[model samples]
Target: MSAKKRERPPVPEILPAPVVDSHTHLDACGAETAADVAVLLDRAESAGVTRVVTVADDIESAKWVVDASTWDSRVFAAVAVHPTRTKDFDDAQRSGVERLARAERVVAVGETGLDYYWDYSPPDAQQDAFRWHIDLAKRVGKPLMIHDRDAHEDVLRILEEEGAPDDVVFHCFSGDAEMARRCVDAGYVLSFAGTVTFKNASTLRESARFVPRGQFLVETDAPFLTPHPFRGAPNEPYCTAYTVRNLADLREEPVEMIANAVRETAERVFRLPTVTRG
Candidate 1:
């Protein structure tokens, strides 16, 4: 029998306004094929994702992330061991992470913080690894990208004790108003993701409502938390528009206004040269 030709899916449409996905993990999703990067970037660029910060959950992923960012000018990198993988941060791994952090494509350190919900790693080890990443970011003079999953108190405490850099961000923020206020008070940027669009996200929405215009950012965290209608499907960077729209609705503002805010905050946090980093 002759092989059947695979159908080409229609190109995903772009949002009318520009945006910047401040956080994502392009290299991790199992479904994302090698060809998807360009196609995904094309769709994202069309949908106004001028830039994206692809976070690495561990030392090895950081290298792939760097390679992806290097291959595509639109993508930048954040490197570190996630809380779940804190056990992986042995001496050799720690040194390698530090070296990767110093890479030109690495703009921040993390996807690292506390994840008490999973507790895949010991709490003490997570804390130690979190502190190490923060210190590495400080030493390298780069920003810090935090991932706090149901461990807000511990995350905040560590950041305070470590004296988090001026450019700290809670990527995929899922905290309450108080946490939002604390982050704002500490001058940390909050990057919202697809989860913000979930119906049960009142607290997250409340936090988003309070985030200052400039201190707020948006992202896809794609190939994972597919937003709303796309939920249950494997997410891609192109679907970020749904997140942008959801954010605008929650903010009771025009999509364009939120788009501009997202772009601005993403540039500030990621220090991308294209947007208003000033």
Candidate 2:
């Protein structure tokens, strides 16, 4: 059987405390309609994931994200052009993204940073776009969600040069303990994804533990980075439970404690309503 179509994982036990998925791409997870969003949110709430921040990677995606946010009160939106797509970013797209950033439902300016791993975009263009996005983030008074990949040094240098937004988050942080500490020291939030659950990610697990409780966040980054035991299968927001559990075990804290901490952090970072759903 093809791994991409691997057997769907059974829902894990419900969490004792509700949590938030700080970052997820519902559009990429095949949620194109209200029905699809309903099914995904139902499974997520069943697993105790009460709210989610869905992000867009391009102009059209920004539209999808805003529309999805309107489809359900549980969903919020983050809009920006991904670094890889910034190579073709034009004046029109820039203005459009700025407009979306001001949308009442939009809560963040990001998924923007440099990606040296993929040559899809030139470095210079990526840097230019990164600076512009950084400015937009500060101007909008929203947290900046960064997508750093194989360009940590450059990302940090650029952020330092451009002056980071008041709220900066390293989404799906893949840095070592040292980098994690630096981020925490700078008051930046470190969001962990399912990769922290991989057996081979000892450094990542160590870094996850090193991050302070209030600075920690859990995410699915879904339809990708499926946690171990379901590593090769596509992921959904409900699967954030597995990553949160793994993080709790790593930090040597009770699952509820860690889940609640992350839930609170996500709410503060994204300005989400901390609701206790029935």
lDDT of each: 0.80, 0.91
Question: Could you give me the TM-score of model 2 versus the true structure?
Answer: 0.97
State residue 160's C-alpha deviation in candidate 2, in Å.
0.9
TM-score of each: 0.91, 0.97
**Cα misplacement distance, residue 33 of candidate 2 (Å):** 0.8
Output the number of the TM-score-best candidate. 2
Query: Residue 168 of candidate 2: its Cα lDDT?
Result: 93
Report the number of backbone clashes for model 1.
1
lDDT of 2 by residue, 188-220 (tens): 999999999999999999999878888989999
lDDT minimum window of 10 residues, candidate 2? 1-10
